[model samples]
Every structure is written in C-alpha cells, then in structure tokens.
Target: MGLSPKSKRRLQRILPFGVIWFVIGLFVLFIQEAATGNKNINPNVVITLTPKVFVFAMISVTIIGLLVGAVEILWLGKLFNNKTFYKKIFYKLSFYTFFLVLTIIIVYPFAASIELGLSPLNELVLNKLSNFLISLDFLSTLGSIAVSLFVSLFYSEISYNVGDSVLMNFFTGKYHKPIQEKRIFLFCDMKSSTTIAEQLGHIEYFKLLKAYYSDFTNAIINHSGAVYQYVGDEIIISWKFEEGIKNNNWINCFLAMKQDLHKKANWYKNNFGLEPTFKSGFHVGEVTTGEIGTLKKEIIFTGDVLNTTARIQGLCNSHNVDILISEELIKELKPDNSLEVKSKGIAELKGKEQKMELFTVSRSS
Candidate 1:
C-alpha cells in the first residue's frame, strides 16, 4: 500500500536510527568477541544471523511499532491536539515507553544470542531469564534504554522538522518561487456537514471526516492533483493544466473523485443512518500557486479562480446538482455526447467583475 507523505517521512526518519542501532549492536558484539581473546570477528555474520530468525524479529518489531505509533499518532495525539503542554509530555512518555519495550523485546535477545553464540535450549532460556531480571538492576540497561528512546524520538522530531523545512524551502524560497504561478482550482464541500457533525458528535464526526478525507484525497493525489487546504467541510485542490485546457487526466481525476464520494455515501448510509453527499465545482483560470504567509507559511493557491470554484460549488445547493464545471473548463475538455450538460447561463461571480458561463454535467446522454 502507498503511504502518505507524512507516513513516508516518519519511516525515513526512523530508518536511520534503526540502522544505527543495528550497527551499534554489532559493534558491541565485536568488542565482546575481542575481549574473549578471539582472533577475528565472525566473517559470516549475515549467515550467522539466520534468515528465519531475522525475519521473525523484523515482523515482531514492525507489528509492535505500528501498534505503538498508532496509539501515539491517533489516540493520544487526538486527545490533546489543543493542549500543548500535556501533548508534549504525553508524546515524550509514550515514545520512551514504546522504545524501551520494543528494544527489550527485539534487540536484547539478538544481543544475547550473539554474545553467547548458540547454546542448548534450556541453557539459553535460563540465561535469558536471568539476564532479563538482572539487567533491570543494571545502569547499562537503564542508560541504553534512555539513549535509544531519546534517539528514536529525536529522529522522529527531526524528520518532521526537516520535511517541513524542505517543503517550505522548495515552495517558498527564492530559487523556485518563480515557478509558482497561477492555475485552475477546484473545491469540493460536503453538503450538510454540520448536520452530520451534530448527529455523530465530535469524536465520531472526526472519525468519519478522517475516513472521508483520506479516501477523497487519495483519489486526488492519484490524479496528479495537490490538495492545498481543507476547511471544516471542504477541501481545496488544484491541478496545473497547460494553456487552461482539460486533458484526459483531468477528466479521469474528476471521475475518480466522484466515485470515491459515491463509495463514502454508501458507507455513511450503511454505518450511521446518514447519507453523505458533496458538491464540487471546477474552474479554469490563472491563480498563483506557492507557499504563502510569513509566521506560518502554507502551501496554497490564491486568486479569483479559487473563490469562483467555491462560489460555483455553493450554487450546487440551489441548483440541485452534484457537479458543476465552468464554461472555461468545458472549452478545454470539449464536451462529448456521452455526457449531458445544461447551461445555467452567464452570471457574475462574487469576486469576479465579468459574468462566467457555468454548466452542470449529468449521466443522462
């Protein structure tokens, strides 16, 4: 499965630390072997680390890591999104605990096996249990656990900071700022979002919204669209079209988005006695695209095109239509006979001076 940018960044962040720990574990094993007056380190270390054993260890670590990360990212993070002090402490404590448990479970055994080599099952078990209890009293255990936890949490924070910095530099910095030009914008808003929120309550409503957002945004990204912003009930996405013309990719993008929404509608109806629906509008025009704002710079699109798209989407509520495409967009797509379009005539938009033509597309041919 494809991971989100955030997930990918987290993995990238954790990987170096994992590798470093693996190396340090190997180094300690080397030192222990040398201290025994051994002539050389194990040449076939990779072979000595049995594939089955390593695979089992990796799988265990992955499962545990996922569980811990989920608890940290989803549960605890959500509980205190607004409370900075408590959230920081909770995250630190959770990170330390997770790292300690995971290291003890996954790393300690490997270290013991390397240090002692292969031994009888009974001896191995006795040695491990004895060491486990004794190690609890050793300062080395506490120090190593503290170091590992600190490293892991530090890596995670660094990754987030670095990724944000990179994105900001690329989008907002002087080098690439010139490429951040205007483009077509689209915004889709869920109808009766407040009603759903009221019915579901805050927690349940957030869960539903998360699912909806993930599904819809996945579709958008698949179509080479960038989701810039998500308001309370709406998402603003933009795609750069050459010469303001809609291509096959853009059409496929809309189709995928609509299909995603349709699936969510079915899910909402089945699960919550609520049918989820949304109205979307697309506009083709010039709009600046780049990272904006000084204190909290954000990647965004700005101009009349964005506002017009929102306005057109709002019109869907009154027009009784689910999708609306602007005339400028239609010119780029070349409306085919397979789809039916009804002209709503020209009307001046909220922020625009000139009247723009709008049309609603339906399945009826």
Candidate 2:
C-alpha cells in the first residue's frame, strides 16, 4: 500500500535533514584533508581518501543524518511541540550533539579500519583510532557537527513558522513578481468563538484555538490544501484551481475536516468543556499572488473572491448550515454521488452590488 499523505509529509520534512548532513560531511572531509596536509601526526594514522572509503564515509554520515532526522521529527518535535521556540532549539541541539558524540565513538573504529585495510579488532587499527580521537581533528569534527546542528535546527524552526510552501517560494523566488491565477479557497471560522472565549477566559480559549487549528492542519495537509492565513478564530485554506476540483478535493477536504473534528469531539469536551464546531465558505476565482513587504515579507492574495467567500460564510449562521459555496464554484466541481447539495437561493451579499446564487452541501448517508 502507498504511504498516507501525513506520512509522506513527514518523510519530506525528514529527508532534507539527511541531505544537509551529507553536505556537511563533504565539507568535513575537505577540512580534514587540509588540516592533515602531506603528513599524519601518528605514522600509523594515514589520511587517505580512497573511492571506497570515501563512499563509506558519505554513507555513514547520511545514515547518521537520517537517524537524527527520524528522532527529531518523531520524538523531539512532538515532545516539544508546544514549547517556546528557543526551548525547542536548545533541547534539539543538546540531543543532537550527544548523539553525534556517540556516533563518532561507535562508528569511527569501523570507518578507520576501512581506511587502513585492517580489521576493526586489529591492535594497530585500535591504536590509530585512539590517536585520531585524541587529536585536534576530533575536536574540529565536533565543532563542525555542533555548528551544523545549530544551523539546521534554526532552519527547521523558520521553515515550520513561515510554512513549508512559503519558505520554498521565498528560496526559489517563485512569487517575487505579482501574477494572476485562478485558485480555490475554503475559509473556515469556528462557531461561537466570541462566546467560547468569554466562557473559557483568554488563556484557556487560546489553548483551545491552538488545539483546534493543529487538528485542522492534519485534515488540510492530507487533502493537499495550503494554509493561507489564520485570522483569529478563522483559517483560510487554498488550492490551485485544478487541484481543488480534481476528485472533488475542495469539498472532500472540508468534509474530512468536519469528520476529523467530530472524531476528536470527546477530547475537546473533556479538555475545554465544549466541543468546537465550524462553518466554511468556498469560492474560486483569479487572484494576484506575490511576495509583499520589505521589513516583514509575506506572500498574499488579493481578490474580490475572498470577500465574497467570507460573506457567504457569514450567511451560514443565518441559513443554519455548516458549509456554503458560490454557485460559480459549485458548477466547476465534478459530480460526487455521495454528496447532497441544495440551492440556498440567490441573495444579495454584504458589500456586493450584485446578488449571487449560493448552495449548502452535505454528505448523504
């Protein structure tokens, strides 16, 4: 069976760390060669970079990287998910440094044996390994590993904060200039957020919102949705026009989100004393997308479709429905036999000169 979307995302995040470590390994190799020059400090400790030994060294560092990445994403990240940014970095750095030291102790003997054409259990190989570990070369490798870990942790934190897509865009300059494209957006707002805040108090309500959005992220990412913005109690998800309509993903994404929340209803009730509910509006149209700002750069979308979608979402409370979509967008969607869609009739929306037909969608049992 193919990996689930969530697992694919986790793998994507983990693999980059391995690549970073491999690159660092290459740099370390060069630094070591430069330091050793034409002579070895110990006559038995030769610094030869044979093709086979070089490949072995590269593979070793890569495996170390993959192991570290797995631990970071699966264990450390979750354990420190709610901690402060610096705290997360500090803990991860400390853990990675310790792991690096342990890796050197265990793997260096085997690697040295390969370079020297002797069994790792051989006395000369052991003596050479001991000399290398006590030499300045070992300290240099430790310094390099420490620097790499610190930089990598900082990169991961920034990537997580700005989001993976946005960071990629920044690095690639894909949206450096404004361009228009048709896109679909799902704007979801938590139901009774104001009342919930009043009931829970500021701190407790923020915690609820944090959990609520974190769960929503799983559903959105699984469905190939990009989180555009989080406006207080509302989250805006976006997709390329074709990507959204393919497999009716735009609609399925929302349904999946609803299902996810429902599955976690008991947890929310137990933790926050109430099960949170949400309403959403969907629309598709052209928008100018690009990187904006000098002091604080960001990618932003500007279009009337956003306003119309928000207005449609506002009608949900009045129409007493969980989801509302623009007639224009509904027409673009492929037929889904499992869906039951009803016309909510044409209505003049707020801040709009023309009226638009709206629809409410539900899953058929």
Which residue ranges in model 1 land beyond 4 Å of their true spot? 1-180, 243-247, 264-266, 334-340, 362-365
Expressed as tens digits, the lDDT of each residue in 72-149 for candidate 2 is 777888889889998898888887888899888788778778877888888977887787778876787789888768
lDDT of each: 0.61, 0.86
On TM-score, the leading prediction is 2
> What is the per-residue lDDT of model 1 for residues 336-361, given as tens digits with 9 covering 90 to 100?
66667789877667767887888877
Worst 10 residues of 1 by lDDT: 40-49
Ten-residue segment with the worst summed lDDT in candidate 2?
38-47
